[model samples]
Target: MRRMLTVCAAVAVAGTVVAAPAMAVAGGEAAGSGAAPWMVTVAFKGDEPLVQRESCGGALIAPDRVATAAHCLDHVDPTHLEVHVGGGTLSEDPGKVVPIKGWSVEPGFRLIPSPVDPQDFEKSSAADDVAVIKLARSVFGVPTLPVARTAPAPGSTVDLFGHGLTQAPDPKNPAAALGDQLKHAQLKVLDDGACAAGLASPGLLDGKSVLCTQGAATVCPGDSGGPLVQNGRLVGIVSFGGETAGKQCGEPTVDGFADAAVARSFLTQPRPPLAPMAAADPVITGTKAAGDTLTCEAPKWTIKPEKTEYAWYYNKVDPANGFEFYLPVEGATTPTLKVTDELAGHKLNCGITASTAGGTILQYSDVF
Candidate 1:
């Protein structure tokens, strides 16, 4: 059976490689930062610089919001994600990093496993794979790309842009880096019958929710959530790719995107309540010595949380492994924790979990 990958947009996660549902410009030319000023770099907080953490690409659809593929963030925590906008050819520029406040995936979104091998993601496909992200603050000066009111005709040509792999990742070259510069490609829209005929999982393409395409140049990993533009408006988001003949690069297979028009309602709908966002980390006050009472204050949040909860933990030294580990104190759900002799010689810390209708977030304070 032929392989159809989700473009592997996400980088290594805790040492495991996950196929990201985005693509990059393969057999295409480099694009300037101005080429798509509304372009966005979706990334996670990591030890590396923001540019090095590029997971998926996105397009700014509102002053304080961006549109991307749901798979790129469906299982991800909003607090750990950030968007880089208004950058140069690079993944990020000075002062362009914006933390994600919250996000919502299309209610109907689903990922279909390959009939040949469920363990193999190279043959996986998706349905209704779109999402909208709320930024911590509004970004001015840059122009936002409006979602197309209707799907483009099958024979029409469209452009795709992204910060993804320039070519299919080689198994032999596992250390190869992802594309840092943005790039663009032109592809022709494919009709439903033509699209299904070329895909390993044709049943996943409903024609309305998916926009199919093909061309000499195509999208590779990291391009997921990147914009597919027709006449200056967003028509689709890079979703997945399939190989009918050649490799995963140029002219290799049919590509799929989350139809922007089909997702218009979810994209343009009124904003919902945002997940809890902390302005500061939790603070632990009081003496560290045993027999002293310690109080942990909830971190200030931009939006008031509906509820706040706390937990106390102690770092203990294990005599067997000689390694330190943390253990939660029993019934430490209040704002105060009374230290006892048993906690002596152990480091203590507090965690505050803030929750709202939108989502929940947990923040921990430095060890006391």
Candidate 2:
């Protein structure tokens, strides 16, 4: 049976229009265990070093890629975007800062009016609110999360993470705003029909590409683009949240997530070849001395490979002629190769080709 759906841009208010900021997790606790290594804090570059502002949250799905909300970078310049990984708070030096090189937003993405009014909900669509950012250099040593191929079953429990506000906004006190510390909460996925019914605008839930959650925990401004993980995989990106009768953040209301499966292909695209010792470059580990055993280590990839092939090449030494010649090393097909005395004076290099669901990538190690 086909389902009827409605659309919304941000939190809906009766008469006032409030522009939604990057959201956060309300009714949640501080993230102390550092459970989410892929969680990143997105901020604007300031004039001084280590100075950043206008923060948002994102997920590191690849060594050089971050998944976020399209609205977060809609009007911002790419050069001004700075990403901080492996941190629970903005003040912590969990990881180094990397500048954004480029980004791609879903073609179907459209901005919802700021301070969205109740009537605006009838005109906006949140189905394609996702985007991916390409970093100037790869992020190494930290773990990257994977996007779910399928949606989690309704009623399943999911974990939401963000560096947003702990309390609802208070108009009387401007200081009562969003949080800077990363927080998380557990939320239960809601059925499409029930999610739609809970909203003031009944047609706001797009069943296929968007889903909602229930319970005391909900996402608020500053949490946009954060990950909704289920069964240890990212299943959604925080898109928007519904308001309660009193126009507060919490239960009887639902928060929306852009279905990860709908944008998995774009999020996991293979990156360009990296420089030596960079994130995705193959490593040749072992001593260069004769008779020593050498092994080729495959570069870490966003997507695991189905198969891998290795080839060893020798740059033969020519005493009389200055010209260099590269000759294939016989019987060195696997990842490991033996260093022979006959090739002691020759330069040695290894080529590794990895085949993944996304595509193929070839990388070479430095000569030993």
Top candidate (lDDT): 1
**Clashing residue pairs found in predicted model 1:** 4-122, 8-20, 9-20, 22-224, 23-220, 23-223, 23-224, 24-220
Q: How much is 247 displaced in model 2, in angstroms?
A: 2.8
71-98 per-residue lDDT for model 1 (tens digits)? 7866454666778885555634523787
Error of 2 at 269 (Å): 2.4
Cα RMSD, each candidate: 7.1, 17.6
The number of residue pairs in model 1 that clash at the backbone is: 8
Tell me the deviation in Å of residue 216 in model 1: 1.4
CA lDDT, every prediction? Answer: 0.72, 0.65
Local accuracy of candidate 2 as per-residue lDDT tens digits, 1-368:
00011112223333322222434333445666567888877776776423136356788988889988766655343544678887665655435677766665665555443233544543343666777888879898888888899988888998888765444445664333445456777888888888877665555566767878866566655677888898778898887764322344332357778888888876776753221222456788998778988898876654455767899989965789878878889989988888889766678889876553323345678787
Q: Which ten residues in a row have the lowest lDDT in candidate 1?
A: 1-10
Pick the TM-score winner. 1
